[model samples]
Target: MNKQMTRAFATGLLAAAIALLIYLYFSPTQDLSVEKMKQKLEKDDYVVVNATTYHQQVNELARLQKEISAMNKVKPTIKQKETKKQTTSKQKTNSYHLVISSGTTSAEIGQKLEEAGIIHSREQFDEYLKDHHYATKIQIGEYDIQQSFTFEEIAKVITKQK
Candidate 1:
């Protein structure tokens, strides 16, 4: 009787597992169509900008890029005039925005940092990354780096290591 009961329990458990698998196999997946996506976005209160707005934004971005390029090319000549008493003023710190996507290498990141005046030499940065094993551990995302950060801090930030 015990042997028969054990056999029955095993059969029932196996049947239940098979039923679960069948049910899962035939279940409907989430709708991934464009219309459904639009609906979801609307439901989440996301605004979809019109073509005119998009075009205006693009133009503004182009203008900003041109201004940045012009600034980079021009070297300002400053005439220092010493006042009676120098006021202690806080200097503004510069920050660079970096976007790293899949397949982005350390060399590219280093070059961008160098161009942004965040890093002195791209080659040295690359070498540091390679030596520290951070080249392969870099996370793919956007990073805001202050000009005061050292190479170690930059590497830690890019690697999401805090």
Candidate 2:
């Protein structure tokens, strides 16, 4: 009877010790100080409290800057096209037809268009045609182009001819 009591007491003490150890291991009372934070940063090479949020913000700012630059860049082209439209309106009221030959260079076509008052500037027309890859495809023939026709219409008219 005495041995049984001793064994029961030993088992209870062992169980209590195990429970105490487990509670201590899983407890959230761990110390975290500035020195510990610095040590963590050094160990991890770098540290950010909200890395993903910071990265996303930086990307958004870069995209906005790019969009602003693009908008600013397009303003000049819009103004130029508007001015050309005004000038062409005056010329269309008193323009004549000019004949163009096949295999004509883009520069020649541009010059003829300008001379016939179809466009405001030969250089501008040439640049436009070149940029659009239409310089080499202009059909050679007599065209009745006038400033009244939009550039788009003129391109279609020139390309539609065999």
Candidate 3:
């Protein structure tokens, strides 16, 4: 009777051990192995980095930010110049009115100006007017030119009616 009882106790113990092993094998409590995790990350096209390396990269970024902030405090001054170029151009483009008789070619106008002693030479005046493209723009009428007018000024005057 003692031998049979001993045998039954051993059988029960063996059955419990087998059940525990099977439960452990089918359990979801096991974490993925490090090598398996790495393979998975690689297959998913992800980069795996250690914690210390990631912290060092963050520290380097902070250092660069501090250096940039320090550099922004110093400002530079530059001098700007005011030029008379636009004013001169505006003066040249100004219009005026002139008094003249009919049938006035650019050469005739130059001759009139020379004869009146307004300009020195008819040839120079004609060339000046021609170079400035004032010939076609000339008008025949009484004119009021501004003091010290250029050929460009006269051309503007001649082209405009009022």
- Mind giving the per-residue lDDT tens digits that candidate 2 earns over 1-162? 699999999999999999999999998996789789878887988854567899999999999999999998999899999998877767657565766776677677778777776777888777877787777777766667767776666766776632
Best by TM-score: 1
Ordering by TM-score: 1, 2, 3
Q: Where does model 2 exceed 4 Å of error?
A: 1-92
Clash totals in order: 0, 2, 7
Better of 1 and 2 by lDDT: 1
The CA root-mean-square deviation of candidate 2, after full C-alpha superposition on the true structure, stands at 11.8
lDDT accuracy of residue 84 in candidate 2: 88
| Tens digits of per-residue lDDT for model 3, 1-162 | 699999999999999999999999998885899999999998999988899999999999999998887765432211111235544654565434446667778888666555654456778867877886777777777766543555555556655633
TM-score of every model?
A: 0.44, 0.40, 0.33
RMSDs, each prediction? 25.7, 11.8, 17.3
Q: Is candidate 2 or candidate 3 better by lDDT?
A: 2
The digit string of per-residue lDDT tens for model 1 on 11-127 reads 999999999999999999886997788888999999777799999999999999999888766633221222212211211345888999999999999999999888899999999
Q: lDDT score, residue 122, model 2?
A: 80
